[model samples]
Target: MANSLSDRSSGGHQAPKNKKYQMKREALEQVIDKHISNIEKHSKKLPGTFDKEDIHDLRVNYKKVRAFLRLLQLEKDAGDLHISDKLKSLYHHCGTVRDWQLFLEELHDVGIVDQLPDCMHRWHRQVFTYKEQTVHAIETTHFKKLLHGIIKELPRQLQEDTVKQFMHQKIAAIHILLLAAENEKDLHSIRKQIKDIIYCIRIFKSDWGIPFPFRGWKSEKELNEMASSLGDFNDQCLAISLLQPSYICKCDYKEQHILRNLQINWLHQKEARQRQLLYEVQELHVEHAF
Candidate 1:
């Protein structure tokens, strides 16, 4: 999968010559340029620094770029311009490291680290090794080429449309999905859909004067807050899963027992949080009458 960003410029692609679509095309190109630059900056530093925040930021930028590409694809037939899978693999490479980092932080916050220092230390070493391998996979010529290609081709793929109408259509689809979502997994998917719509709005709204469609149910702030809550619920689920005996076999019997107990408690907490979040999502959907 592609990892590092290449220095290949967008090949000096100019905005559409047609005056009617000039501003819209420029807005699209600007959004693509900004994200490509950000992704490149962070991806280049990955091999040298291997910082957790860098990994996170790179993934975020990748998502932004992917979301922008998705918008283009939705607007027009962007054949051979879809780079979601390659970017997704790159994101997952860093995601493993991120998940472990978050898991470690959760352990520390819940006092598990202090109680089972030896076990935590051993797990930390394993996580470090995994991160090294992931980084190694990322810092390659193929990865660089992939990043370069996406940035180089994106501007050419964007087509002009009424920004406000497009935004309304996309957000409305996401709202329908949110209204139909019934469980934690569904809620998680809804959060991602909402995130994509937010990215779309952010890019278009940067240079175009388009107002958001939803009134009480959707705003950048509201969507972000909802996604954050869902993120916490997801982290708890992952933490409990990682605490399973099969995964933490290095732990002694006493440590294993402690982990099992912690897992059980977290499971209960996750259930409650999931329930509350689902209710909140339902309420928002109703208020919006999607």
Candidate 2:
């Protein structure tokens, strides 16, 4: 991915002649189709698949398409990313499964789930149930219509000049978020903003490759590292909150009681993750728009 990213931004296969920053019409259409297809591919593969990466990839594809729709939506006259209530249900179903996956993975990582076999088993069962639910949503949802709407919205040419200007505005917004961020929500805004940059580039690339942040910007790896840290802290925070007595835990009262007894361990872990994320943010230096 890193090598391909470098190749793309450095005037490789992604951009058209003269290696312009913008994508061509045909390239943009291919990108749109690719993401829609990949979303289906991952959603199908996740039904009985044990690999968590598939779930992550499915969500990534969802975000990529959603980002493109969002861009078009902002233009008002272009198009809107208006998901039907049914489609929104499907989207949330996927999220439900992902949260279960994250909830378990974090517990297992901290050795909490490992100590309680029953809790782990219950969590896995819940994940399987939600996974099947997501599969059902995929099979029944009107995604074909949603995808067709996006295809119909394609413009004659996705000029680089327009995309570059849009990205510059987003980066400028990120700059403001960075200086004003005093809490985790602010950090999340920063992370999502960087991801918007990434999603836009990958949406245009045929290979779904991440593009190098335009000239005079942080490397793709560095940007990912920053996002990773913030994501980790977020997962940790979620895991801790799930342990609270009011949460609708899948574990029984007895098991939930046992889990709550060890809540301090997860709390400590969350604090450690918080510090790591803060350090990452402190060292982060957002260069002005390219």
The reply for model 2, stretches above 4 Å from the true place, is 1-22, 72-77, 81-88, 112-125, 204-213, 248-257
User: How well does candidate 2 match the true structure in TM-score terms?
Assistant: 0.79
Q: Could you give candidate 2's per-residue lDDT for residues 138-166 as a string of tens digits?
A: 88866677678777776544445566666
Top candidate, metric lDDT:
2
Q: Which candidate should be chosen as best, given TM-score against the real structure?
A: 2
**Tens digits of per-residue lDDT for model 1, 27-121:** 45556667766766786787756788898788877777777776666544344556645556667877877788888888888876878877887
The clash count of every prediction, one per candidate, is 2, 1
Question: Model 1: runs farther than 4 Å from truth?
Answer: 1-27, 84-86, 141-144, 151-180, 205-219, 285-290
lDDT values for all models: 0.64, 0.66
In candidate 2, position 117 carries an lDDT of: 73
